[model samples]
Target: MSTPQGGSSGGKVRGWCPDAWRPMMAGDGLLVRVKPRLGRLTPAQAVGLGEAAVAHGSGSLDVTRRANLQIRGVTEAAWPDLLDRLLALGLVDADGGREGRRNILVSPDWKPGDDTHRIAAALHDRLGELPALPGKVGFVIDAGAEPALSAESGDFRIERGSEGVLLLRAEGRAVGVPLGHGAEVEALIDLAHWFAKSGGAAAGRMGRHAAPLPDWARGSVQPAQPKAAPAPGQRELGTAYGLPFGRLKAPTLIQLAQTPGITGIRTTPWRILLTEGGMPGQLDGLSLDPNEPLLRVDACPGMPECPQSSVETRMLARRLAPHVVGRLHVSGCAKGCAHSGVADVVLTGRRGAYDLSLGQRAGAPPLRAGLDIDSLIAHFGAV
Candidate 1:
């Protein structure tokens, strides 16, 4: 049998830093990931996650773009016990082996008593029973709250429509599966399972394909209500400066936890972090803002970390970050692993160089030839 890299007889593993830089290995013998329900973990859950990291695996936890938490360095022996603990914490009651398949991204500001959680729980239970569904099948439920991350980008989405209707979408297109309250949630799941078992190519996201509706259903539904505007003096915090390359040091994370009045931490799929509270006066020293260019940039690991990477994409992207606008994503290869949706700018690594593409489609042809880091920056800057 093939042993995992960096592990003895056990399954010890190692991972790369941001954009696949320096090597970082887990001291423990296992890597265990925790998926947060609806991206809302209570203060108790936060403390539990921190403790789980320090005791079972590494003293660190990674918040993934899917609104989940990952605990590295787990040992095989500790797996059952850890799962038991997590389940007891009310965070692990979903379907068997269905945790990964329940990739739902809800609004960051989802309230505590909203019906969205009830609907998510039902969908998760249903998904658990259907093991045949692809592991990447995802569902997102948005309440039209602020700091919306997965609303537009989710594979299956449920957004508020008018006062009584709830809009349902499959692959970012309206599916005409309108219903009241929790009615459409299960319908959305059935639609996803149908697509998965029908041998439809894994689009990796729902919006990648078009959803066809019956002729009678066309143009009958009204447009969804406009999302509520953010209040005055309120700004959405961007996830740019928490750390270099997406990993924050343990001490810094602890310090962030200790800050008072911090409603919570919101993690995005782009490997960025957002603080619900405004930049605290005490945190003024840290170079952070809701609109920094670095916060809007994303890159995948390249070169040393991923054996398939041909060039150092993260460093190259960082060097070019200052010249881009809106949101930019840099991938190590054509696979485009870092981003799930259309990016304003995409820099994909090629044979010892880079290729740039504009617009959101990943497979689109490059706009320019593979160029070096400096030349790439200059070219984008000129545009």
Candidate 2:
């Protein structure tokens, strides 16, 4: 794996993410994000991904908030070879356009032929029929007995209703319309067209769009209760492990992929992975304690690793993790790629200094500014 050779890359926010066909430039090199099929990976595919990460980019992988995997530090020269390897492993979409459109997040708890699995497969097959959407628009299929992905990010959600009926929900709405058993995908396609025709593209996100949903798309049928976020430990289906700060090294991934009794792996947006049918054995770099404070913190690859960052982040976050309470987001910049949602404590980096904010997202105005790492540690130490 190549180490990051920092360059004079400008600190700017690129509105979209990188796919297998198109990568994004950063301070270290280029970044290629892989959206797995329903975030499911066979052991062989997982091993291949780790190998590719080591061979073509940096030896590190990021488990993104969208439950995708990112290979960082790739040079322009290495991207084509990496893309070929990914395609051969059956981990990429043959058509980049369809791949970009198929940004569906599945419930990791799905069984072999369950609603989550079937609906996601059907959506994948029907991707070509949907209209072009904003790059960040996505769907979440949490059709488990209870919705487990409510807090995760997505523009549209397919979840169980109060009476076990499947409902299709617009993102910002509190309720959703129930769908017939066989019509989930078709209804979804209709909604996509509705969004496009209603001028949703300008808003860029379903939640942000101002237009009211049509009568057919609105209902009072509340979604079923949400399940608790999975903690790091043994679960009925497998063992759950947390990636500290949502990152895993190539060696650790390869080890987990090769572990005995592991049938497959499921990724979640909460920095957790479920190793199906596997026991908690020798997990060298993963967190097993649910109460680990660092798990509550979100920090990006700040400074030299990310061109947009003005200061180093993870280390400072670590130092403050235990000292602070509630959810903390140490953003490298105002973009807050690490955690876009509101956090209890937010520290935005600017001009090699930190700006402190409380109970807000990263871009919100800070209560104080220009503090150094030592000052932050001192401030948190008092808390």
- TM-scores vs. true structure, each candidate: 0.71, 0.95
Per-residue CA lDDT of candidate 1, range 45-97, in tens? 66666666666665655556565666665655555566666777666653434
Output the number of the TM-score-best candidate.
2
Angstrom error at residue 164, model 1: 5.4
What does candidate 2's lDDT look like per residue over 1-383, in tens digits?
33222222355565666777767778778878899898988999999999999999988888988889988888877888898899999989888888788689999999989999999999999999989898889999999999999888888889999889999999988899999998988888888899999999999899999898987888888989998989999998899998888988988888998998999988889999889987797576699898989899999999888878999999899899998889999999998999989999999999999999999999789899999988898898943
lDDT against the true structure, each candidate? 0.56, 0.88
TM-score: model 2 vs. ground truth: 0.95
- The number of clashing residue pairs in model 1 is 10
Per-prediction CA RMSD (Å): 6.4, 3.0
Error of 2 at 61 (Å): 0.5
Clashes of 2: 0
